[model samples]
Target: MVDVATLEKRPPSTIALLEEMERAYKDLPMEAIVKQDILRQGIHFLPEAFQVIGEYKSKDYFIFSFDHIPLADLKDGADTKAPEEIKIQGGYFDLLKTVISTRNNPHSPYKMKSVEGIPTLFLGDISIGQAEYPPIPSWYKHKTKNGKFPGEIAPVIEWGYLLYLTVFRNCQYFGKDEECAYCDINHNYRQQKGAGRPYTGVKDVEDILEVLSWVDQEDQVAKVYTITGGSVLTSLKKKNEVDFYLQYPEAIEKAFPKRWMGKLVAQAFEKEDCRKFKDAGIEIYHPNYEVWDKQLFEKICPGKASWIGWDTWIRRVVDSAEVFGPDKVIPNFVGGVELSEPWGFKTVKEAIDSTKQGLDFFMNKGIVPRFTAWCPEPYTTLGQQAGPPLVYFCELLRAWKETFEKYNLPTPPGYGEPGPGKAVFSVSAFMDVIGYSGRN
Candidate 1:
């Protein structure tokens, strides 16, 4: 068995691990490796660090809890105080600016502590990096007519480059057997409600519109908006999955008529069903394939495997390319899940080879697949097991970048400018690996 005790040690340092990855994958950016390691290992903060992060757009518990620990386990109230994301720069490695989504893991080797009244990340007393929290957007200071917070209706991520609207909070993929084994969406909803936060279950259309109006009028940074929610196997508010999610984009477009780039994250639909979303004014489509290997896909995402099967899902993703055009149909895979315990690959090489096949399959057809580095939240089934090694993620990013350039694909739309130091998509480094000219 792999030793958890050894992995959790603060000696050897985060910088050392990053240097090892840098040596192995020299072509991949040092920024992407550190970003992936911070994601895989997570980060800790001193109490004073929270006070320093005071009102700078704290985490909204958007979609999933995205925490390494459960809501019930946070005795120090770090959940409420943690910043939405942190930008790392200037340390032993002389790193470029790298943005990483926050995932709370108290035992991580990387910890955020205050030094001379400023927040910094340390590895065994060595200051590996300096950190900066995203500035609170102007719209966050405004409240809706019914007294709803802007955070509840719309939350900005990627340094306010995208507005995230999780229209229906909960997924119908209920219970341990039915829901994706790696998912914490249902549990996150319950925790947010239990914590007495004003998290709306099924957000009203007008409420979303009201928040968008504020963003459109006052915010200059936001360039895209994604309308998404949990999987709806049956119906939500008496509407099918497609119809329910389609309404948000439809209403937004009708009201504003293409004011910003629009995207949708939903279950895979037939070509005809996808056309309705296109007709409704959605410019980009993300039908996340979760995992690439068939057995792992079945075991990890049981609902998707049972409902749609891998072959049908891939076909629909390709079919939708005809409707939305190849560049606009970007499917996502959860990057490191192929190495999860109980059913995943036994080694990093096998895992990367398997995922590389999926990348070639998609990109060969002019469709590009994106990924988010997996975080094992405490409530999900997979969270009961440990996540993959940092090596797996480093190798995966290298492989993904190789395939993407092999196809000579353009930068996928909706996401802001790409390449190291310029990418704002925090969850994954795929954006960080693309070539950019800084012309956003």
Candidate 2:
């Protein structure tokens, strides 16, 4: 949150940009357009507004920093003070209850400030909505025998609707030549350590079980738990990539079968490797095809391109659908990565057309893809520059929604409910744009 006394004035053109985008993209919800802009640009929270989230759940740095600026650049003590996500309800544009992932940017024109101790979201001077912070879950009070709180071991996102367990904090993709250009996993892990926070690089298996035990007993809102982390290229405690991540689900399912829907977000493994996860009782598989464009995929994700090669990686994605079932094999693609510079499509139409070809290829076979709106976190390589325009995201959503309907696909499972207000997967408005009513 910012120190209001030292807040600097920013250009008012951003508000005008938002209005222009809204007017142009009338088919898409105003909520979707505004949320995309806020995510792309990031937000600066005034101290007065930060006070409104008293004792609420703060960010756990799940995998990436997801901030516009690096942790060192944040002057406002927003590193640990800002709420995990903000839910804003009807105000300036009569916006529905939209849940947005918090990304701190001190210079953003969109600021969160308090008006009479009630959290109010603003675009310049205009009110957008009243912001609501997510309350701390009941399980947060309990601790494991090793003296670790459940919140650190397994943090929940989407307003406490899903449990996120990033078991391997750091990726084996070590440097600029290896790691994905847009990813900040290694850097964020180092920064968290520098900050003196209790960020574990490799969480213990028993610790995960102990924490989830509390979640099992105390939590009811959590319907899904995702077991994920940075890729394991070499070894994690003498276990290969598949063996290392397998322990969590194998143990969880053994203890409580079908307790909560289990999802795995990992590297694109071959059919045989993927079946081990399915056999271990994992319900959904997300082998995220980071981007659809082949040439950009090579330049941006060097390690993945080198190790598996783009063709092999895509085949594995389709092969995984056979083992996990097409509907359950949900491969994720970074929505805006294809539009990144130095090695991306120059036009929005070109970007959409290239991505849609991939989408259609998957959807035709029944494998569905979902995306998280890209955050131009200034720390990462591609993120050093700005992301795609608001128009790109708007059209992306429209294409995604229309294609989903065209294929007559079922809603992707695990993320709570579809449509705005009801949807809790806040990282992107993919869920928000789907089945949106005027209310949400």
Candidate 3:
């Protein structure tokens, strides 16, 4: 419970801005607007807030350290105390059940505290909603023979709706030369190791199978499992990227064929190479194109642009559709990277317009792209700067929705559900904006 005096209510201007956006984008749900802003700006928890979080699942650092500040910067020891995701409902705006990923920023206006002994989220002083954390899965208590916890082996995210298996923790594209500018994968691995957490660089296939045995036996909610890791530009364990990544799904499907939907998040390989994953029972492929604008893509993802080249990367994304079907070939773009400072577009309109073109291109081809809200993590090259404005995200959501509806694409397979009250894809509001018949 944050001390009442220690928690400052949001300044008047902040609430006004949110209210104004809500009114302006009447067709878009107020919940989506708030969710996007919460993600963009990040959240803070008062020391007392941990009392409520202790019983729920804590942040797993599943992939990237999606925090605005590094673990060393947290004042109230929030790094280890924060929940994986928080669900908000019945706040000042009477928000529906909206799930937002936990991105620790001790200075954020959005604060979580136990107000009057009840867990609540406060947007500057106004109580927005009662807060609830995802339950720690029963399988979480189990560990592998190598003394690795299931969380470090294979963590479940999206509020326990999906299994996240990060087989290779470190990306080969290290430093400014190759690593994506907005990414902190390499830095996060170091921080976790420094924190003395069991951060494995390369998890063994046997460990993964051991974890899944618990998932298969005790878990009932996880329907999809994604096997992803940092890009293996050269070779990992004497295997090429495709061959290395293929082992997990290959093994999983071999052991429990079709027990759960298998998805792969890896580099966009040649069409023929992707067929190997499909044949191994992987149903979805996400060759993430970090950003859309050609200039920005090269600038933000130098290694990817240098190695795959933007044209071939896009081409392979399209090419993979033939192997996985158009609907299954879903590439992800960091939603607000086009609005990043320095090399990015100068204004929200320019950014959205540029991104819209990319969305239109892929949507026209029957391949849909999804995005996670960018957190300006301090360790990355583009670190600690204020991220894109909330307005940019709202406009981006609108553009994404209009373009998606224009194509009449089916609901993306692995993301749990769609629509405002029902959406569980916490990173972005793409899921929330769907079925919004009110789109103007």
Candidate 4:
């Protein structure tokens, strides 16, 4: 176990950690540096900042409760008040409209404060940049016939570039031993319900279609839709995992017929199962290989480790290349988890080398894998541990960029424009580090 006393009692300053990383990897964009740090350390909002977020696109708690603190513990009502993301620009770093997913950490050094009536993000009272909350899209105002909120049903993220459809709210991965050690999906479901939020456990296809119908008619900023949920290890409804998920794409494709790019993040299934998704009009497949190191993979993702062993999971990702086309088969890694305590690497270099091997393995196959920086939520088993160092993320981004360029692969699909300030897949800086020529 990690030294919880160290993580909770008192922690190092986020800015200090970031500055050390910035100096170490000077070549990387400062935007990415701050992005990774914000993801690692999470963000805190002042009461005034919360007042301003009231007018913006609020966080929908799409899948996991990505907050460091739970909903019940948000004394100031930050859970309901926080925006889905904050776009940073015009400050010391001169950041160019960089979008970052909001992971609420009340103790974080990076605090969102108000300045001259405008909300801004500060690092230890030293203002880093002005922050902009995503404007509430017109579609968000619409509601389903059953009176479910549109924001709860189909929320958009990455600066309104992708319509996120978390079809199933709860994962079947059960308790601590079964779920990913760092995941809080099941617990998040209970907390959201306990808080009296209208969170749906299993979203209906018609409700998804209803939301899409509104999005299809009213939204232009949304270019893609991702149908994802926590792992459906067994039958969710009556159907198996693939069958249950495939129905959404089939229904959408039939209704809209390629109106938007379709992506699916699910378990690593056999090629036959993959063909079902491809046939259903899925343009991109993300069978996320959460961690690269085998021993750590087994420890971190016990459910995946037991259900679909690491070797088989990887083989399926490779097998998917034939069905989805190598370029379209993008596997995702949880970028920072390789350095988590106890089971992970003892040093940053080892972690990066292991992750790089996974990257090289896929990129060399003309298959591009992507990653989201890991957030250590308090409810998760791994939450007791401190996340990896900021330098590890900076170096990992550099390693990813180098390997991506070495193979000269096209920018992966589903995510919007790549490069600093333009990329919208905000859970990590992987998208921000890719070549930016605008969307392919």
Candidate 5:
């Protein structure tokens, strides 16, 4: 077991730790290392920081809260003021441009401040880089005929490279026993609703279509649209999980006829169900296996374990590759959850080895597994404790890159280009580290 006291405490300095990591993981880009550290620890925006953020794309509460603290705890209007993602470049590391998603954590060593006139990311006294906020999509300025803003209906993320549509916001996983311990989906819904945000529970096809019309006509940046939401365990809108999610893609493909690459993030399903999505024009399928270890999956994601069973879920993920094409069938694991508090591995080496097993299992078959650096949101079962250390993420980036290159796989479709300064998949450094040729 990890020593809680020892694990929770930071080293003498954040910069020193980062520099040390840079030296150790020579193959990984400095941009990726810094991006992962900011993502793993989350970011704190000083009150003055928002002054520089003039009309940027704000966080849409996309899918999960993805914050270290609750919305109620936000004191500086960060809930509304914070940008959806920040692109950092040129600091102590002389980093290339790297995009990172926003996750609010007031206590994190990384802080966002407006230095002179530019939004800059600072770790201790060191200026990590100049931070650039995502631009407001033109469609964001217009509302649907029914008065819903396009952002609420279909927000663009990954620096506006993809449109995110969470059709069923609440998961059927219900409570502590069922909900993934690291996920804040259900809780985020409640908080978003409680805060009086126009957060939709079950989005209407008409509403989504209207927003897509705006995006199709007004926006040029988005190349992909993802139809995802919480798992429909019993039934949502009186339809089973696969049937419930299938409608959106069907409507999108029919209406736009493949205007943008379509991707679906939903629970694993049989080959028959996977074919329906492939028939509907979805280019990619993400049956998110939240964790790799059987025991960890059961402990961290009890609902998925109980309903689908690990063995069956694994089989479905492999089987669906035939329908979507193995390269297109991408499974996502929550990156650091293998080291999550009580149930996680005792050491980073054990955690890396366990996750790499999952990576190799799929990648060897041409199904690439990607990860979002786990954010320990306050509402989830495992949120109270600290997340995995920064070293864990650095190791994960290296492992992911090594496995990806071993198979000589193509860059996963829909997630823009890869490599430092070019990648737009901002949630983690998996994309950022690709094709990196920095110091060894």
Candidate 6:
């Protein structure tokens, strides 16, 4: 019999795994299947492929490191050379344009190579698709009056459909006891500083406004702006979490006045507190509940459990629906985290069942839940571990799609178009699987 370590070291063939999952989940688009695999495992860039760095929007360390390996471990300056995201199309799969966020994992079977002088994505020796990097926004050329790069202050993600502003780089939730087990916000900040990147700890409102002024004047592709960062537990700059976070949208809407779809990702708040964001012109709210399992919530999110308690968190999420309206009050869970090691469910069935329950609870009330495919980045409390199988993500996507349609819900605002190929929401296939009518 093969030893567990040997079995763990050798995964089933990549193409074979895709084929098996395709047959098992035929309703899910092939585009989404491939996207989820890349998101979970990350991609390694060849030296030749790294040549495209300056020509495109490179990874900005926008929030978390979002890499399988830390910056210290990545060779050949991949930390700075990797593209913010890649769009895959035309290969063995004849895939449509699918945008996927970049996560560097040198060991991932998927590799970015310059195949015959063309940028390409490969699984083992098989070419998956022609890879296209996002173009640099013209405004990225300009610096804030204080000498800040636009990408550092305000970066565009989702193929330039969303402006990602991480105002507070460091979370007040310090140490393993307080940080989310799978998160690396605090660690990513340290690695960035260690690497001598000019990452800001806390961005001033004026600096953010200055960046947006350039964005507003020069860009038209950005349809939404998401004001988000690490959770503010006690206080940031002497302001409470609400006051600290609320200031961004409040200032943006005050300055721009509904120029872009305004969104916020923060802790779940009471009905009245939720109104503060709504009143400030935030059209969409994302109170990300990282996982659905109750026990996992206690173990994985001890800080939140200790500070707010899961019961209160859930209640706050539900109550916020009144303020933002059910459809606009979207919540995000970290996909595949329900199956994380040591504390997670023993089987996918248990994980799916638990997550599906949460979906039903929310979707039944017109609140559509969303998720980002979990990347097990290093140095977090969970450390580096094998993420859930591709099948788990496929199942989660299906559950999300079916529940979404069951309610005949509108596409959650802020995220660009839903459905395979057209989806720019690179983090998870939840958006890609939307409106899919089974594979041909």
Best by lDDT: 5
Listed per candidate, the RMSD to the true structure in angstroms reads 3.5, 5.1, 4.8, 4.0, 2.3, 2.8
Off by over 4 Å in 2: 1-13, 437-440
Task: Please identify which of the two predictions, 4 or 5, would achieve the higher TM-score against the true structure.
Answer: 5
| Residue lDDT tens for model 5, 1-440 | 22323533545338878877877788888888888888888889998888873688889988999899999898697988889999999989998899999999898889999889899999998999999999998778888888888888898899999899999889889789898898888899999999999998999999999989888898889999999999887888889888899999999999999799999999999999999999989989999998999999999999999999999999999999999999899889999899888999988889989999999999999999999989989989997577787778877888899999999999888789988899999888888887876585
Residue 178 in model 6: lDDT: 85
State the lDDT of candidate 6 residue by residue for 1-440, as single tens digits: 21222323326448877777777788888999899999988998988897653488889989998999989888976877899999999776789999999999999889999976778999988888999999999999998999999998998999999999999988877887888899999899999999898999999899999999999999999999998988887778999999999999999999999899999998889988899999999989998888987789988998888889889999999999988999998999999888888899877778899999999999999999899889998899888888887777777888888898898999988888888889999898888888889965
lDDT (CA) per prediction = 0.84, 0.84, 0.88, 0.85, 0.89, 0.88
lDDT of 4 by residue, 50-118 (tens): 766357888888888888888898857687888899999977667888999999988888899998778
List TM-score per model, in order: 0.95, 0.95, 0.96, 0.94, 0.97, 0.96
Error of 2 at 431 (Å): 0.9
lDDT string, candidate 2, 1-440, tens digits: 22212211222336666666666666567778788878877889887877763688888888899998889777666877888999998987788788999999887777899999998988877898999999999889888899987778999998988889899999998688889988998889999899888888899989988888888898888888899998888888999999999999999999878999999999999888888999999999999998998998899899999988899999999999889889998888888889888888877778899999999999998998999888766667776676777778877887887788789888898887887667777877888777753322
Q: What lDDT would candidate 1 get against the real structure?
A: 0.84
Ranking by TM-score: 5, 6, 3, 1, 2, 4
Question: Which regions of candidate 6 are displaced past 4 Å?
Answer: 1-13
Provide the lDDT at 161 for model 3.
Answer: 92
Each prediction's total of clashing residue pairs, residues at least 3 apart in sequence or on different chains, is 0, 0, 7, 0, 0, 0
lDDT of 5 at 372: 90
Clashing pairs in 3: 1-48, 1-49, 9-124, 9-125, 10-124, 10-125, 91-128
lDDT of 6 at 245: 92
Error of 5 at 86 (Å): 0.5
lDDT of 3 by residue, 38-121 (tens): 998788899878786257888899899999888888778688878899999998889889999999988888989897766799
